[model samples]
Target: MINGSTNEFIDRISTCQDTVFIYKGKKYWFQGYMPNENTVHMEIFQIDPAKEGYVWEYNGSSITEGQEEFQIAPIFDGKTFWEVEQEMEWVDC
Candidate 1:
């Protein structure tokens, strides 16, 4: 919790994965962490728009990597997806 508001790290959903967004044809993997004070349950994978691998995590757990659907929301970051999905009916990316 950066500011206790949770919104502090909200928009980082897209860049929060081991993905390859090309420009000079070089891919970079950014790291994101969502600590729940104790344990961390997350899965990093790729969905769409990004042929590379993206990560989606939460304070809990998911069924599998291939089961994470719903893009406009999940943000595919990890903790943010978990937090937003259950609260706002957002989709998992």
Candidate 2:
């Protein structure tokens, strides 16, 4: 249910698969997804600030720190996010 702004996010979700996202130069790893009205809440893997990117699912977004509580969070993890999107029938091939 993501809009155009999320297309690149979606694309990487399919193609890259393993590329991590770095937000505020921090890691926002792959945690899970949630139910949003139009866009499903992309739950980023919570970062511990004490760990690095390769350890957990922690791929952060260039997205700002406070952005997490904003109106939108990107499809955080590419691979699984796309899988969930496909399962939810949000995007078409």
Which number leads on lDDT?
2
The TM-score leader among the candidates is 2
lDDT of each: 0.35, 0.36
TM-score computed on alpha carbons, candidate 2:
0.27
Q: Count clashing residue pairs per candidate.
A: 2, 11
**Which residue pairs in model 1 clash with each other?**
45-54, 57-78
Candidate 1 C-alpha lDDT tens digits along 27-47: 223334445444433444443
* Native-to-model Cα distance after best TM-score fit, residue 86 in candidate 2, in Å: 25
Query: What lDDT tens digits, residue by residue, belong to model 2 across residues 1-88?
Result: 3322346555544332333344434444443222333333223343536453333222333223223322233343433333443333
Report the poorest 10 consecutive residues by lDDT, candidate 1: 19-28
